[model samples]
Target: MIYLDNAATTRTAPEVVEAMLPYFTEQYGNPSAIYSLGSAGKKAINEARRTIAAAIGAKPEEIYFTAGGTEADNWALKAAAECCAGKGRHIITTKIEHHAVLHACGYLEKNGYEVTYLDVDRDGILDPESLKEAIRPDTVLISVMFANNEIGTIQPIREIGAIARERGILFHTDAVQAFGQVPIDVEEMHIDMLSASAHKLNGPKGTGMLYIRSGLKIRSFIHGGAQEKGVRAGTENVPGIVGFAAAVRRALSRMEEKAGRERELRDYLIRRIEGEIPYCRLNGHREKRLPGNVNISFRFIEGESLLIMLDMRGVCASSGSACTSGSLDPSHVLLAIGLEHEEAHGSLRMTLSEENTQEELDEVVGHLAEIVQRLRDMSPLYEDFMKSRRDRT
Candidate 1:
């Protein structure tokens, strides 16, 4: 099968797996234990922390390991709110954030905190001026994503961080999709809190990290043993952490080469799809986009139906629809970008990986063009468009 959904998750790299295998078997000891084997495990954890910290220009002590991006996001928001409880009760974020941040904000709102969800422009970008306008005296935190997951639009995080720093509000960014794909320096960005997931960068699942700037006082989100300097409480998954560090190292070391290759293939796919397909529109920014993301909306067909068709042809892709409470609803991210309900329903997200080749891109474009045409032929919207065209003729 041709896998094209790297944004959701990536396949673990062989080197990462090799680096983790020894820990799962030979180094099978709790990091908190004091015996020789356990000491080795503890040392491994510390090294992983240092590696990950260096990747983002943070101190090893400031990096707190968690279950994944969701947990990190939760910890960042909850801890920030609790730390500044005496100072304020308001937060700011964008509408295009992952559900992790949005739901956390929702929970905060229910508990008497105020939150401002800023709108995005047509290109799915949050205006820095709009963010400045949203800040009130009570606003204590600002959370925005480093890059959008579905549409691949990179936000003006450095500008937003500067704004937040000048205002004395804490800045947090969900960098789950941007960590391995782009260059990040927390010190230069002035980010107080940052979230990253291992699986998104070809490392193991169930492992991630939250970077909290040192000297910042934040309450603990989890209470148990003093695993992560009392900031997070849990037994360390030694294997996953090792794999995460290895993956981060490899991805960063080869980022320039991988990025160039992925961009070439991505541009090839986009050009072919737009030139060969009918009644389709590309979503997200044309140039300032991720190296391996292509989101498109076919005018007449539902995204789910097209996805199934592509799957049948051995191609994997995703739609922006959600199965919430057993009812299918259009994706909030799609709607937030100004797509109508029906238009949003027709959205397809195709994320590429560096491993994909030009041959794979060719096959995917060919299959997707066929599937979209087949689905549009049965669409009522297509009939309407045809009728309108005939009337104009």
Candidate 2:
């Protein structure tokens, strides 16, 4: 199959698997134990933490390991809310955030916090000026994603972070999709907290990290032992952490090369599809999107139908996020970008990885164009839309 859903999750690299194998069997002792094996596991976790921290320009101690990006996001938003509660109970975020951020914010709203959900531009880019205007004296934190998972539009995080910093408010970004693909320096961006998942970067699943800037008084999400600087509890997922670090090292080593190739291929695919298919438009910014992201909306065809057709043709893509796969509702991100409900339902998001080949992408796009045409032929909505267009003319 030509897999193109890297934004949902990536295949764990062989090197990452090899790095994790020893930890699963040989060094299986808990990191909290005092035995030699435990010490070895502890050492591995520390080294992994240091590696990941250095990648993002953070100190090792400031990086806290979590189950995955969702957990990291939960911890960051909740902790920030609680920590800044005394100052103000208001938080700011974009409406296009991943469900992890949205749901966490919803929970906060139900409790006591007032959250301001900012709207993104037509291309799915958030406005820094809007964020500035939304900031009140009671605003404690601003959570904007680094890159949107559905549309792949990269936000102006540095500008937003600068705004938050100037106002003495904490800034957090959900970097699950942007972590390994882009260069991230927490200090340089003035980010107070950032969340990333390993699986999105060709690492093991169930492993992620939250970067909390030094001296941030945040509360713990999980409670038990003194793990993760006594902030995140439970024994570390030593093997997963080790594999995540290995993947980070590998992805960052060839970051430029891989990103360049993916961007070229993504553009090729987008050009091919738009050229071959009628009533199709690209979603996300033309140049500011993720290197491997290609989200497009077919005017009348259902995204689910197109996804199934692609799968049948040995291509793996997605309608939107895998997290919200079963939901029948149109994508919130698409709607936020001014798409009608029908347009949102007809969107397909294809995200590539370094492993995908240009030849495979070409084949997939060819198949996709044919599939979209086939589905449109069977869709009465397409007929009605064309009829209306002819009538208007």
Candidate 3:
């Protein structure tokens, strides 16, 4: 299959698997134990933490491991809320955030916290000025995504973080989609909290990390064993952590090279699809988008129908966020960008990876053009368009 949904998750690298195998078999020991084997496991986990911390320009002790991005997001938001409970009960975020953040915010609202959901522009970019205006005296935290998973639009994170810093409000970013694909320096960005998942970057699933600035005084979201420096508690997934670190190292080391190739391939696919297929419009920012993402909306055809056709042709893509793919509702991201419900239903997101080649992209473009045309031909919307054109003539 020609996999094109890297944004959902990536294939674990062979090197990462190799690095993790020993931890699973020979070094299988509880990191919390005081024995020799436990020391070995603890050493591996510490090294992995250091590696990930260095990659993102964070201190090792500031990193807390978790089950995945969802948990990390929950921890960051809830912890921030608890830390400033006496100070404020207001939070700020965009309308297009992943469900993890959105749902958490919803829960906070029900619990007496006031939330301000900022709207995005036509290109799916949140306005920094809007964020500034939305800040109230009770605003305690601001959470924005580093990059949109649906359309791949990079946000003005540095500016947003700077604003939050100037105001003494904590800044949190959901960097799950941008962690390995783009450069992230927590110190430079002034980010107080950040979340990332291993699986999105070709590491093992069920592994993620949250970066909390030192001395933030946030409450623990999990309680039990004193793992993750007492911030998160659970049995450590030593093998998964090992694999995550290996993947982070490889991704950072080869980021520039892989990013260049991804940009080329993504551009080629977008150009081919828009040029060859009629009534197709590209989504997201043209210049400030992700190197590997190409989201498009084809008029007169549904995204689910197109996805099934592409799957039959051995091409894998997605219509919306992986977490909400089963839901029939139009994507919140698309609606935030001003797409009508019907138009949003016609959207398809294609995310590339380093493993894809020009030949594979070309094949995908050809198959997509054929499938879209076939489906549109059978659509009543297309038939009505033809009738209108005949009347105009």
Candidate 4:
């Protein structure tokens, strides 16, 4: 199969698996325990923390392990809101954020905290000026994503962070899609909190981290024992954490080469699809997007139908986020980027990995063109729209 859904999740690397095996059986003690086996577990967790910290220019003490990006996001949004309730109960975020942030904000709103959802430009980029204008005397935090998962448009996080810093408001970024694939420095970006997931970078599932800058204090997320510096409590997933660190090290080591290759292939696919298919438009900024992301909307075809057709042809892709796959509604991200409901419903997202090849992508593009054409032919809406255009001309 031609797998092109890396944004949903990646195949765990063999090296990461190798590094995790010993922890599963041999060193299975809890890090909170004081015995020798537990000591080994604690050591491994610390080493993983340090490795992950260095990769993102954070100190080891600032890294707090979590179940995954969703948990990290939940913790960041909720805890920050609660932590600064006295300062203000208002939070700011973009409309194109992953549901993790959006839903968390929804919860906050139901519980007395007010949230401002900023709109993105047509290319799916949030404006720093908009954020500045949205900030009020009661605004306590601004949580914007580093890169949009559906459109892959990279946000101007540094500029947004600067705005927040100048206002004494905390800044948080959900970097689930951009962490391992793109370069990031929390300190340089003035980010107070950043979230990342290991599974997105060829590491084990159920493992992620939240970076909290030194001197920043958020309330506890999970409560039980004194794990994760007493903030996130629970027995650590030693193996998953170890594997996460291994994957981070490997991904960063070859990030430049992998990104370059993926960008070439992504550009080629975009050109091919747009050239071969009529009434299809590419989504997101052409140049300021993720290196391996290709999102396009076919004018008359439904995204679900196209996804099924592509899957039958041995192509693994997505219409939107895996988290919201089965929903009948159009993608919020697409709609937030100014697409009409029908246009949003017809989008396709193909996120690649370094393992994909030019030949494979070319073949996928051919299949896609044929499939889209066939679907459009079956669409009465498309035929009527074309006839109307001809009549107007």
**Candidate-wise lDDT, in order:** 0.89, 0.93, 0.93, 0.94
Off by over 4 Å in 3: none
Residue-level lDDT tens digits of model 2 in 1-393: 889899999999999999999999899999999999999999999999999999999999889999999999999999999988999999999999999999999999999999999999999999888888899989999999999999999999899889989999999999999998999999989999999999999999999999999889999899887988788889899999999999999989999999999998898888888888888889999999999999999888899998988888888899999999999999999999999999999999999887788799779878977888888889999889889989999
Task: Estimate the TM-score of every prediction.
Answer: 0.98, 0.98, 0.99, 0.98
Clashing residue pairs in all predictions, respectively, total: 0, 0, 0, 0
TM-score: which is higher, 1 or 4? 4
Off by over 4 Å in 2: 389-393
Better of 1 and 3 by TM-score: 3
- Candidate 2 whole-model C-alpha lDDT, 0 to 1: 0.93
Question: Judged by lDDT relative to the true structure, which candidate is superior, 3 or 4?
Answer: 4
Kindly report which residue pairs in candidate 1 clash with one another: none
Error of 3 at 171 (Å): 0.2
Tens-place lDDT digits, model 3, residues 1-393:
999999999999999999999888899989899998888999999999999999889999989888999999998998799779899999999999999999999999998899999999988899999999999999999999999999999999999999999999999999999998899999999999999999999999999999999989988898987888786788899999999999999999999999999999989888888889888888888877889999999989999999999999999999979999999999999999999888899999999998999999889888988898899899999999989999999
Residue-level lDDT tens digits of model 4 in 154-210: 999889888999999999999999998999999889999999999999999999999
